[model samples]
Target: MFDIQEIRSQFSILDREVNGKPLVYLDNAATSQKPNSVLDVCHAYYTELNANVHRGIHTLSQLATEEMELSRRKIQKFINAEHDFEVIFTKGTTEGLNLISYILTQKLQKDDEIIISYLEHHSNIVPWQLLCERTGAKLRVIPIDENGILQLDYFDQFLSEKTKVVSVNQVSNALGIVNPIEEIIAKTRKNTDAYVVIDGAQSAPHFNIDVQKMDCDFFVFSGHKMYAPMGTGILYGKREILEALPPFHGGGEMIATCSFDGTTYAGLPFKYEAGTPNVGGNIALGAAVDFMNRVGHENIQNHENALLEYAQRHLLEIEGLKVYGEKAKRTGVVSFNLEGVGISSDVGMILDKMGIAVRTGHHCTQPIMEFFNIAGTVRASFAVYNTFEEIDLLVEGVKKAQRMLS
Candidate 1:
């Protein structure tokens, strides 16, 4: 059985007050609050095992190296990768995508195309843009419907022999719609030889991820979005593909040997991880994986689904309040705007004064905002610890904003 209160107790930040009212945190899509277990593990790493990995022969270095690799293995099993070395440690999803884009510069030629969707975060979009600018490749975008779901039928028009890569997010951060990635991958395989990439940043905390089953050539997600610390993330690539690609950064740990004449690179993961990694952050990420395993994905899904449904139902009842992606399948996010509020940030400020935290603005997807012909939407995203009562508070807060602004 999943105990709501027991789960809430694990996140101590939920107990704090904001502006003299009990804090209701709903900005989870940006970053999640870390659990006590993740916090404790991070502290223990700094206190007990503070040494550089793979360089020193001392006891602390050995222990630190073991813990860091152990974290890599934990992520490997969590995502069901074929090999532990395929799970490369990255700073976050942005860096992972940038690394891939940098390496592909050698492969992509003039007029080669890279496809992405209307729902991607800027991290997924800009790197490809840079790649196109550098390599003389063309960047194509798959359009979306009015309801914020991808229009998969239009995807065929974009797929061709010139296509070299197809990268998309599994979930939209601005609208919170879960995309049809499996179907997209299937269609891509049928049409072209392009490598498929899935940005799992928004979906990793809410659902189970099996990269083997998904069959994407690359999958990337951030630990900070899933109860782990910032500056830690994962980039899982197929071993053969990773081996074929050149190293993104050339530095100390990523080298086999160095001389004035020439230099050779190291093995699979170390090739991508050049400098000293965030050993404690990665260990905390492992602890976060363990925490999620203990609580179970089924429970997380059910609880978050409940929160989403309750929030949608309540928020939509307000006069002139519009919720984006209301008709589409989504996870734990609700983006809406009040009728009279000129800017979404006004609503967010009003909510914050009432101790209701939400995110407002373009949400790093300015194209999405431009598509809707609006500045931005107020986004309230839920996590495992959020409750029905919090949704009630959000409803009242939105109503208050509406009355005050309109």
Candidate 2:
């Protein structure tokens, strides 16, 4: 059985206070707090194995390289990727998406189409937009209904033989809706030869991921969002697709041979990973993955599911409060707006004063905001360490904010 208190104890920051009150951190969608195990791994890397990886003949360098590769393999197993070489180290999801967009654009031509959804974070949207801008490919969108669910009916309307790439988030960062990615991928496979990409930044932390089951051409996620150090991320590509696409960057590590006149790039994962990578972050991310394994994804899901349900029921009880994205299946995220409160920032500020940390603003998905005819929302997201007491505080905080701010 999963012990909530014991699991909470693993994270040291949860004990601290803010604003003379116990901190109720509900801003997990923005970034997660790291466990002490992950932090210790990062600290040990810097203190004990502070050496450059993959080049030096020294023992420290070799150890660093081994640890880094071990992390990659751990990620490979975590995601059920077919081969270790399929996992490429990246700065974060944004960089991974940018790399994929840049590389895929090379294979595109005029009049090609790239499809994305309205639920996408700007990181997923902008890279494809840039790709379309450069390649003369028409950018298509998969629309969403008022319930924050994807309108699959429109997918066939936008898809065609010209469709070259389809990229979407597995779970929305702002609304927390789990997209029908398997259905999307199946339909895309039936219609076109487009390469499918999944932004797993929000999904990887909440549940188990299987790249083989997803069968996506590329899958990207951020380490910081999964309780690891910042600047560590992964880009998982099918072996065939990765080998075929041109490298995203050129540097010392990604090269097999280089001359003043010409350079030949390395193969597989190294081909995409350029420059000195985030050795400590990647190693710590491995520790984070192990931590998740120890706690078990199913257990985490069960706890968070109950928490979200409890929060939603409590939030709906407050008069004039409208919770967005309730009609669809969601993760541990709830975005809402007070009836009279026009500016979400004001509510966020009041919550902060009350020691409740939540995210406010467009959350980088302005299209969704525009869909609801609102500028932004107050998002209270949950994680495994959170409890019912925190939800009570959040509710009281929201009601207080309503009376004070409104």
Candidate 3:
């Protein structure tokens, strides 16, 4: 039922060549390439429906507003949120995390604790650190093992009645480990009344998310990581929780009425979404969501899981190559290093020369690098369009890098 070639044909960039070879885009963990459907929808939005949302009374404004709100509904359905208004448009996962931190920390008191994990992206970590500095809250970290899995047992020891918030990534961007978020959320609830926030920037691309089932207070993800354009993402919060939190940014759109005496903020999502939004990008993001639903996430998961397995099996064939985070569950990412490779960037450059794209360096998780006791590892992340043959090319490229750099 799953047609790999049909799926590949939808992405126009896959036909292009880089450095005289077909581009094997394995850098999906950074940002995914867009499909023609998303591109076409974006073009149509700009060409036909280019107008500001909410404030416009003209026909174009009404149409644009409809599309923008439609995208919110689409995201709500995609994540199975209880209410469409719970989905707030954000620039991306980073902005969502920062917004959540800023609003939630207002409730914190001195000596209140915020719990995070060692597997978190810097986006998930730094905002909490800044929040702690602002509110005098203590930042607690749940450690991970050498295999890159979280030491979940330690979560009980850190979480207490004083814990105000708990932020974690559902998937590690650097290591591609699928964290036990459901279990984590359940445990956090048992220990304290902390608000649980999940960073789904990586996991959203590979798995189906049901916020109602997961029962997390806040969930955030980037559209670019899941075949949508950059500068578009979503933040889903419980309706009451969002209403309770103060406005993140203040401006024209987020306010209900402004007077010389006082100002009242808009209801639900609009209170948090200040200023003009990216209407075109958000519509395209809706199209991207539709594309995923059309293709079916189950098919995407099966195909990507197969690719991950194939890549891991073949990559291990090379001598002195060490793969990080061989956890029980993972997404379509492989971060590895050759025994003799002095720097990850060198290996990445060599792979690029061969038209194999991968991510190098600390990947914005310096804490993860510190745990690994290395600078970084070369990461090759797959998407739905990627094939096993591309994985072969990547393996060969890694072997070539090992030989040439050694």
Candidate 4:
């Protein structure tokens, strides 16, 4: 079990008072607040050892390079990848998906297919659609049940010899539906020559991730979503597949030797990282991972699940409130709409006055909104640092919004 009060003290922003009200931060899905350890590590990196890596032979460069390499190992351990060479750093989740899409399209031929799911974020869907247009391949979407879970039973119908890739989220960001990813991977691999790409942006933060157990061809996640700084992410490709795929970008750091007619690309991880990378952010990511390990990832998940359970039971008591995505054992996420409220945006404004910070909109799954027959939902996502008192305040704020909107 986690020391809940002790963990809350680690986040500096939680101490902040908003308009004489303790801030109620329920926007964990959009972005999580940084803890002090993550911040300290970033400051220490710049103040003590700030040097470009891999190209330097001096002491500062050596220190920087060592830290950079350690960061890679930290990420490898975080996802339980087989090797550090398999992990390639990127700007964020969007960049990771783009890199995979680009590399796959380069390898694919005309009339090939890539499988996607309807529950995916636009980040996962749009890149594959673009790849199809670029390579003359077709985009095949795996349908979802009315409950927003994948209709994984029908996956085989869409796959064939021409299906070269199957990219889907391990957990749906909007619906908080955790898919049976290992089963999906086994089924897809048994039937076709498709490479499995997992969008793990939501899954990485909520649960313990093990790429080896997943047996996935590719796994991608953002550091910011997992308590690291923004603009730092990773893409892990199996060694055999990564070695075979061509480089996604061309630039200074990605080349070993270049000539007028021929150029030799850099090594695996460096090959993916072009030009000046986010050294500070990457160092901070390692710190974030260290902090999470100290707190225990399993403990964090358990605490957050309890918070979600508490919120759900209390949220339903509000008149004219309908909770969406009531799947079995959800993550720390709840999407709901106030009934008889023509304008949820108006409700958010009223809640803001009371210091609640729930998100209102399509939540980046506009297609899902069309399926649910609604414009959007007000989402209140939770994090480990949140307390029962804050949840009570969240309910009070929502009830206040309901009365005002009604």
Counted clashes in each candidate structure: 0, 0, 0, 0
Model 1, residue pairs in steric clash: none
TM-score of model 3 vs. true structure? 0.99
| Model 3 lDDT tens row, 29-136 | 999999999999999988998999998799999999999889889999999999999999999999999999999867998999999999989999999999999999
Per-candidate TM equals: 0.99, 0.99, 0.99, 0.97
TM-score of 1: 0.99
Global lDDT of each candidate: 0.94, 0.93, 0.93, 0.86
Q: In model 1, which regions exceed 4 Å deviation?
A: none
From the highest lDDT down, the ranking of the candidates is 1, 2, 3, 4
Q: What lDDT tens digits, residue by residue, belong to model 4 across residues 164-203? A: 9999998777767778888889888899978999999988
Q: Which stretches of candidate 2 lie over 4 Å from their true place?
A: none
Q: Candidate 1 — worst ten consecutive residues by lDDT sum?
A: 149-158
Candidate 1 residue-wise lDDT, 126-168, digit = tens: 9999999999999999998899989888888999999999999
Q: What does candidate 2's lDDT look like per residue over 258-324, in tens digits?
A: 9999999898888888888899999999999999999999998899889999999999999999999
Please give the range of 10 consecutive residues that has the lowest summed lDDT in model 3: 325-334
Supply candidate 3's per-residue lDDT for 398: 91
Scanning candidate 2 in windows of ten residues, the lowest lDDT window is: 267-276
